[model samples]
Target: MKDFGKDLDEELSSLDAPPLGDLVGEAVRQGRRVRRRRAVGAVVGSALAVAGTALLLGGPLRPHSGGAGPSAVVAADVPSPSPVVRQPVTGAALLAAVAGVVPDGLRTGGYAAQTDGVNGAQVTGAQVYLTGPAGTGMIRVFVTSGESEASCFTTESCRRDDRGQQVVVDHMKGNCVQDVVVTSRHHDGTVVQVNVATCLAWTEAEGNKPTAPALTEQQAIALAGDPALSVWMTAEEGLRAKAAYPDLPRIL
Candidate 1:
C-alpha cells in the first residue's frame, strides 16, 4: 500500500496539470470495502479520468486480513485513451497572428491558407508574400500534430526555448537560396514552423532573387511562438467548415 501510494503520487505529478478534485479522500473512504470488486473498479476508473492517461495498477496491495494470505498483483487491461479533439485554426486567423508581428517596412502580398479539398474553406496553416527594402520574400506558418522532429542541418542552429520547447533556426544564405526558418515545438507536441525566404513561393526556383529574407531569424522565431498561431480544429469542425464556406479563397 505504501508503494502503491507513492506510485500514484509520482504519476499525478508527471501530468501537465494537477488532477481535479480530492481523489485521495475518496480512495481512503473506499479502501474499507475490501471485499467489493466493483468499488475497486470505480476507484480505478476515477484515477484514469483524473490522470488523463492510462494508469498501470501493478503496485503492491495489502490483504484485508492481518495475516499474510497470498502475494497477488492486480493489473487491468484498459484501452488506451483517445487523442484530444480540437478546433482547427483558419487561414485568416493564422495570417492575422502573423500580421501582429510583421515589421513596419514589410508589406504583405498574395497570401493563402490550406483549403478543404475543392470547397475553398480554409483550415490550418497560412502563407503570405512580403515585399520590403531588405528583399521580396514570403512567410509561411503551419501547425502539425504529433511530436515530429528533424535534425538541424549544417547551416542551421538548434536551441531550447525558455518555455520548454526546441527552437531550430536556419538562415540559408548563399548563391541560390537565401531564407530564414524557425521551427518551435509547442507545449502539446504540436509544431509551429515559420519560414521566411527570399522566394515568393517555395515552388518557384527563379523567385529567390532577394539578397536577404524580408523577415529575420528573430522575427521568424517570434511568429512561431505566437499563441494565436498555435491552434487546431477537430475533424467535425473541419467537415462543417468545408460545407459551410464553399466560396472561401484557395490561397495555399
Candidate 2:
C-alpha cells in the first residue's frame, strides 16, 4: 500500500494515449461524414415525394409527347344572334302592303272613304283610289266579323281561292262603265271586299256612264287576298284602326 497509487499513475502515464486535438479532429470529421449522408438521404426522399405528388395530380407536370412546350388551345367562334323582323301593322302599313302588290301601271292616288254593306250588315273599310292608263278607279277593303254565317253573294257569282277562301266577283254592267267588286271571306271569319269602280266621264256633268275599272278581275282578287288586310280583324289592330278612323265601326 505504501507505493500503490504512485505505481498506478506511472503505469497510466507510460501507456500510449491519443492527443486531445487529434481526438477532437477525428470526431469532427466523423460528424461531418454522418451529416453529409443524412443530407443526401433527405434530398433523395424529397425528390421522390415531389414525383409522387405530380403523378397524383392530372400529370400536368409531365413532359409533352411532342417534346415541345404545351401548345395553346384556341376557342371556337360563336355566331351572333340574328336581327328580329317585325310584321307590318296599322292602317298606313296595311295601305302600303296593298300598294306594293297592286298590278303594274296602277298608281296609288290617295286614301278615300267608301261605304258598303255585307249581308245587310253595315261595315266600314279602308279605301284607296288608283289611277292608271286603263282608267281611274277606287279600291276598298272591308273587314267584318260573322262573315262565316253570311251568304257568299246575293247576285254575283262566287268561287273559292287556292287558299279555300270564298271569293265573290260582282261586275256592274252599264254603258261606258266598268265596276268590279271582288270580295273574300278568310278562314278566320273576316270578310275583305275590294271594289273597283270606274267611269269614263272625269266630271259628273259629262254623264254618269261607267268605264272599265283600272284593275282586272284577277288583280282585284289578288289585292283582296293579301294577308296584310287581315290585321284589321285583330283586336289590337282594330283598336288602332278605330283610333285612326274614329268613325270606324266595330264588326265583332
Candidate 3:
C-alpha cells in the first residue's frame, strides 16, 4: 500500500498541483495550484496530464450516471500507502473517521491531525479551506464556493464518512447540485481521493501496484472536473495536458 501511494502521488503531482498537493502524500508547505472545473479548492495532485485534456466542452458532458456511484481512477505513479485524514472535517468525528480504512501497520504510529483556512480570505466571494492530517501538520482538501456548502475527499474515512468512495451526495450544495468526491479506499485499508463539485468525479489511487494511493493520469484529470475547483487548474488556461501526457496503463 505504501508503494502505491508514492507512485500515485507522483502522477497526480505531474498533473494536478504537486506530489504534496496532489492525492495522498507526505505533507508539503501547501503552495501548489492546479486548474479544474470552475472553483479552485485545494491545489494538489500526483500525475495530472496536460495538453488537450479529455474534457468535454464548457457545457454538460452528457456523461453516464451509474446509479451505484461515480467512476474510479487508479494512478500509476503511486509507490507507497499511508493513511492521512483531511482536517476541519464535517459530518463524522475524527479518528473514528478513518478507523477501519488504513492498513493496521500504516496507522501504527497513530494519525496526525490539524486544520487551517486555505488562504485566510485571500480571494473574495469564495473561501478556500485546506485541511487534513499530515505526518504532523494538516493538508488542505476542499473549497467552499459559497458560505453554506463545502465538500472534501476522504479515502475510506469510515468513521467520519457514512458514504463510501464514488458515491455522490447532496451533502452541502446550496440548492441540490451536490458536493461530491471520488474516493479510492478498498475494503482493505488503501484510501485515495479525486473529488469533484459538478461535472465529473475521479479518484487518486495507484494503478499497477496494489499498495500505492495515487490516481492514474486519467483519474487525475477527472478529479479536476469540479465546476468550481477547475478555476485554479493549469487546464483553466486551455493548456493541452492530454496531448502532452498519455493515459497511464493499468498494471496492477
TM-score of each: 0.48, 0.46, 0.20
Which residue pairs show collisions in model 2?
176-210, 176-211, 177-210, 177-211, 178-211
Ranking by TM-score: 1, 2, 3
lDDT of 3: 0.25
Q: Please give the clash total of every predicted structure, in order.
A: 6, 5, 75
Better of 1 and 3 by TM-score: 1
The residue-by-residue lDDT of candidate 1 on 92-174, one tens digit each, is: 55565566567777887666565231112222456667777755676666554434344444434777666657677654333
On lDDT, who's better, 2 or 3?
2
lDDT of 3 by residue, 42-92 (tens): 322222222122233243234344443335332333333433322222211
Better of 1 and 3 by lDDT: 1
Number of the predicted model whose lDDT against the real structure is largest = 1
List where candidate 3 sits over 4 angstroms from the true fold: 1-92, 103-107, 120-252
lDDT of 1 at 177: 23
* Regions of model 1 farther than 4 Å from truth: 1-86, 115-123, 133-135, 148-156, 171-178, 202-211, 233-252
